[model samples]
Target: MGLILGKISVETPKYQLILKTADYEIRTYPPSVLAEVTYDPALLGDRDGGFMILAKYIGAVGEPQNSRPEKIPMTAPVITHSAEKIDMTAPVVTSGGGGSTPITMQFVLPAKYARAEDAPQPTDERVRIREVGERKYGVVRFSGVATETTAADRAEKLRKSLERDGYKLVGEHVLARYNPPWTLPPLRTNEVMLPIE
Candidate 1:
């Protein structure tokens, strides 16, 4: 019988822990690029469709479009709801009044290929590669599924904690997952990140 090798996880984006609170942390991350797709979940609610489309462009299910496309190592916590920073006491819930909002799913390109031009193009038109500039974040760590309710709740808690600590909010919250869906529930890693300035 042939040898069996389990899945290998690639390195996540580079970041430095800058501060810690009773329930959250402050981290700063360097600018990096990502391949993403923005779709109105109201119309395209099926999660698999968006994933498959982006996957194909990233060579997850098809041939790479670039000279070096070989299914760039998959990053953690496939983000279904993503962003950074804030204003006002309101959470500014972006769910578009309960499910009418657009969802932008993304895959963080590896450090070696973080530039948009350096990255592969998606065969599917729905997918596009873009760069994310460096920014500081207020992060809250949690376990279990990274669903909307969980993400929203953690985001509010993080935001409130940051504000309580005298940090000025600078951006929206981004949902980050570090493990595939199949990973054991208790072992999964999830974070809600908000920008600060």
Candidate 2:
């Protein structure tokens, strides 16, 4: 069954499993390039807003890249996190208030593009390409249609589990979904990830 899924699964960021507990797992991921877009959650309400922009960047919408249209293969999981105020160098800034936080959605580039420069530039300026350094995360996996409420609940669960194990969490919880919207709810794969010290 796993092999069958692997055959049809989209490319996901590579990670080494460092540890696993009953509730969650600790994994170390190497540095990788990502194509991302940011949007105001207060206005957009959900990831669909950012996902569409990144879909275009990755040619999922048949959009052209720099010069010629480069269609990059789709990858998983689609990562979403609330943009931190400190990282507000981009035009998208979030002022703390009622649901005004800006959310960033990222698509991990294929391994062939090891560096940010190696990846094709997005025609949309809103779509930024960045390289993140290697990092460790405590992740809790679940399957379902991940709504905001569900994701937040899972994140809290993951946080408690990590804290219980004496892990110092470093950043905001990240939600990653690995299947297209059309996938069956029970068959979909989703994860709530918290960076750890």
Candidate 3:
């Protein structure tokens, strides 16, 4: 569904595909600007609250430089990762269960933004504009509802495949979802990604 949406209208992050296999793919992405927000799953009752905050910002709910809200185009693949402290050397395995830990959700800004400073400002301090450097990742794609359990399972599998391929995995595993909640589970596109050396 995400592939179809991206092809038809939605914009997705651009990456250079370095390798592909039945189980996973390795890709290198250029630096990009992102609008991100962190929320406590326990406090918010779920991840939806955090997502709504970002949605409103991009929906022109933010306070821009000109004092008027600027509407930014929505993008595909809303990316998420655990915001808790983890061992840098050890691979992160999400339990997929609700907890008190914080989760960070990010939306990749359009390429026209170029840099973090070029993006519209969010009235809510929780929403931050960050500039990420070029990164390489090993990603595993799956269909169906992207539960924490499902995302964790895929991430673990990708971690093993990347390690077996002689690639060193790093940071938290990232889960990318490319559809709205109403999308059918079977048609939804979800991907588990791990940063790699």
Candidate 4:
């Protein structure tokens, strides 16, 4: 599908929806590119603080070698990985800093730069281009507030439901948030996703 850009049309990466149930869906995402940054939870323990830094990095806030830095249109559902260990109190931070690993925030690159090699280089060391290969995932969809407990509970629910239905989970899970801070919790879109067989 072409996206309207001031009378100019642009095509974005096509994410295929394969199946859906009352609580979840399965999807196959095309090979895509992203720009990501890892943040220390001690410094950014909330969703707002980390998002602010990540947004600036993508926009090339203070990077010197970045001139004519393209304003890549932001896409829906920013993906974050905590890897393992969740703190119900710090749900939005992704990384609760219970361990040494930091949290990762990723912004999908526009289809114009579909391949990581074709994407403009991020001069900011904090930001780097990451090319992701096509992958299939099981996603549990939910609305209302996204607290640490809610995200964890939802992920567990998805895992149980998938297992009961004879699906095998092959990878760790991640959280995908689809709205800004200003979006009302009742209307915000969120998902708990894990790669599956």
lDDT of every predicted structure (CA atoms): 0.70, 0.78, 0.79, 0.67
Per-residue lDDT over 1-197 for candidate 2, one digit per residue giving the tens place of the 0 to 100 score: 54224233678888999998899999999999999987775676654578888888778886655434678898898888777643312222123213567778899988988998888888889899999999999999988787777777787777788888899977777788888877777777889888898
lDDT string, candidate 3, 24-112, tens digits: 99999999999998877777778655788888888834444221377888887889887876653333325213655678889998999
Ten-residue stretch with the least lDDT total in model 2 = 88-97
Compute the lDDT for candidate 2.
Answer: 0.78
TM-score for all models, in order of appearance? 0.83, 0.86, 0.88, 0.79
Give me the candidate number with maximum lDDT.
3
Q: For candidate 1, what is the TM-score?
A: 0.83
For candidate 1, list the clashing residue pairs, or say none. Answer: 77-177, 84-171, 84-172, 85-171, 85-172, 85-195
lDDT of 1 by residue, 81-190 (tens): 53222243434335622445556788888888757888866656778888988889888888776666677778888888889889998767777777666766666778
Query: Which portions of model 1 show Cα errors greater than 4 Å?
Result: 1-8, 47-49, 65-69, 82-98
Better of 3 and 4 by TM-score: 3
